[model samples]
Target: MQRSTPRLTRILACAAVPVMLVLAGCSSDSGSDAGKGSGSSSSASQDQQGGQKPATVAPAKYTKLPNPCKSVSTKTIEKLVPATKSKAGTSGKSSDITSRGSCSWNGLDDNGVKGSQYRWFDVSFLRYDSETSLGVSGQKRAENNYAKEISKAQATDGAKNVKTSPAKGVGEAGTAIRYELKKTGEDFSYATIVTRTDNVVITLTYNGTGYAGAKSPDSADLMESAVAAAKEAVASVGVANS
Candidate 1:
């Protein structure tokens, strides 16, 4: 009976060793899994803390605009608007000269019995800035405004025989619009050119009216003068920036 008891004790001890080893192995596996979960959680938290970046906008081409009254040459103005009241050109009211500006000239060429010829000319400029939130470039904004100006000229009230066509060698892009209107018992001819260069938009308008018994000015002549003046104005933008 004594011998049997000793053998039983040894067997029992041997069984306990395997059971303890199994428990230790399970504990080690649990610790390793916990460490792996902690690492994954930290990485995910870091990713959440960093927000998405904003989109980058392109740089503007031109930063400044030319002086409105001096954008066109004096000789050009004189030829376009004969007998001008102000050779220096009358500047339009502008809150921000850098962003927007304008100049105008008007005159009356009286011809005794032949009636009178009235001429008017005006030019305006608008500059745009690059925006990040909108993700739009200044040149793109100018392009949009250029289209709007052409549409406005074409939609002139009481206009007859309206025509619009492209003008070459004027700027990056240009459009010439011509129309006739009867106002105050006289026929008035209008020619407008809208062009864009870089980040600036240039709009030039040349108009003439015949008073008394004078014949209305020819549309072709007015358009030619407008295109010439527009080319000068477009060139001025580059000069000013340079």
Candidate 2:
């Protein structure tokens, strides 16, 4: 009877060991499944927390544009164009185009070729005061109106790859508009329009410069330089009477 009891006890112990191991393995599997499910839920919650679409990153060059109007001067402008054309204002205004010291390269119309060398420049000065209040922010309203008009003109004129950027207003002056136009035949143009108001005097300048890329390589810089110089010339035109 003793020998039978010992053999029976050993058999029972061996069977109970496998049952415990099986239970442990089942528990571990259940825990692992729960952990995986929690991980999935957490990921979904995180995704929901970010409610909007991903933001697009623009190029640094486009985002950070250099002030192309830096260090502009009338003397430097005159150097670019040795010839100056004089025109008098017929409206009995003291602010004639040339009298205002707007110097330019003459006969630009007759220079180079029609589409190759038609680089031209012009500057205008308009005065505004309390009597000419168009908007609360100096000439902001006028500048805005002019920008809109230019946009419309560009659209109607079938200009391609058009980019318009404006700078912040300085003092009581409004803002400046810098634009780039690329034509179908690789023709390019650069322009700027600005309104500066100092004390009661307001000066506005508009310059359109074009270069024949076919005649030279990448004339955008030349056009930019010319327009900036023109702006300087226009700004030099103060109140006619003052």
Query: Best candidate per TM-score, number?
Result: 1
Alpha carbon lDDT at 141, candidate 2: 38
In the range 144-198, model 1's lDDT, one tens digit per residue, is 8889989998999999999989988889999999999888778899999999998
Against the true structure, candidate 2 reaches a TM-score of 0.39
Clash number for each model:
0, 0
Question: The CA-based lDDT of model 2 is what?
Answer: 0.41
Best by lDDT: 1
lDDT of each: 0.88, 0.41
